[model samples]
Target: MNEYQKFREQIDEFMQHHPQSPLDEAHRLYFRGLFYYEPSPAYLVMATVTRFSAREPLVEMETSTGDRRRYRRWGRAHFTIDGEAAALTIYANPYEEDFFLPFRDATSGKETYGAGRYLDSHRPGLRQLGEGEIGIDFNWCYNPYCAYNEGYSCPLPPRENWLAIPIRAGEKVFHSSSR
Candidate 1:
C-alpha cells in the first residue's frame, strides 16, 4: 500500500478502536470506516505564499458552538489543479503556533464534510513560507471533530477559502445512520 493508504488505515484504526475517538460508543459499534477519493496527484501541491501586509485586519470566525475565534489574514497560497487556478488564504491564530487553513470545495456536502475540512502547518516564525513554500496535500485534509460528534465546536471556513472546483481528495462524509 502507498503511504497515504497506510495513513488512512491508521486513522480508521484509531477511530474504530481508540477510546478517545470522537465517535461515541454507539457509533463505534457500527462504524465501517471513513471514505476517501482515489488518491489524486493533482490535489497535492507545493504552493507559493504571498504574505499580506501587516496592516491587514484580523478576522473573527464563528464556530459551531456560537463561539468566535480570532485569526489574521496571514497570506495566500496559490496553486493549480487540473488546469484550474485555485488559491486559499492562510490564517494565523495568535494563540496557536501553527498556520490554519479551513476550506470548502465543490465536493462539500456531497463527498466531503459539508462544513468543510481543515489543514494546519507549523508557523515558519518569519510569517513567510518555510523554504519559500509550503506543502499543500489535500489528501491530508480532515474533518473537524464536529463532523463525528456535534458536541465539539469547529470553526467554519471563511468565504474566501471556498473553491469552485471539486477537490477530490481527503476525508469524506461520515454517515451516522447506525446512531
Candidate 2:
C-alpha cells in the first residue's frame, strides 16, 4: 500500500483498538471502519499562506457543550482544487506552536460530520508558512471527537472557513450504533 493508504489503515486500527479512540466501548463493538473518498489528487493541495498584517479580531467559537474557545484569525491558505479556487482561514490560540484549521464544506451535515473537520499545521508545517507555501492535504482532515462521542467538546468551524464546494475527501459521517 502507498503512504496515504497505510496512514488510513493505521488510523482505522487506532480508532478500533485504542483506548482513547473517539468510538465508545459500545460503538466499538459494531465499528466497521470510517468512510473515505478514494485518494484523489485533486484534494491534495499545496497552498500559499499569506499572513495577516496583524492578528484579526479574536472570535469565540462555541463548542459542542455550549462553552466557547478563543481563536484569532492568523492567516489564510490560498490554493486551487480541481481548477476551482478556494481558501481556508487559519486560526491560532495564544501559546500554541501549531495552527488550527477547522473547516466545513458542502459535504457537511450530509456526507461528513455536521460540525466540521480539523487540520493542524505543526511546527514543521508552520515553518513553511514563512516560505510562502504549505502543503494542505485534505486527505488528512478528520472529524472532531464529538462526532463519535457526545461527551467530547469540539469547536465548531467558524463561518469564514465554510466552503461552498464539496470537499470529497477525508473522514465521513460516523454511522455509530449509538447514533
Backbone clashes under 3 angstroms, per model: 0, 0
Please list the residue runs of candidate 1 whose C-alpha ends up more than 4 Å from where it truly belongs after superposition.
Answer: 122-132, 177-179
lDDT of 1 by residue, 1-179 (tens): 99878888888899989988999998888987888778887777877888887677779998988999889887888888889888999888865546889999999998899999988773111233385576788877889999999999999998999999998887888887532
Best by lDDT: 1
lDDT measured at residue 57 in model 1 versus the true structure, 0 to 100:
78
Q: Lowest summed-lDDT stretch of 10 residues in model 2?
A: 122-131
The stretch of ten residues in a row with the least summed lDDT in candidate 1 is: 122-131
The global C-alpha lDDT for each of the candidates, from Candidate 1 onward, is 0.83, 0.81
TM-scores for all candidates: the values are 0.88, 0.88
Candidate 2 structure quality by residue, lDDT tens digits, 50-136: 877554567799999999998877778998987889999888875574688899999999999999998887412233435677777
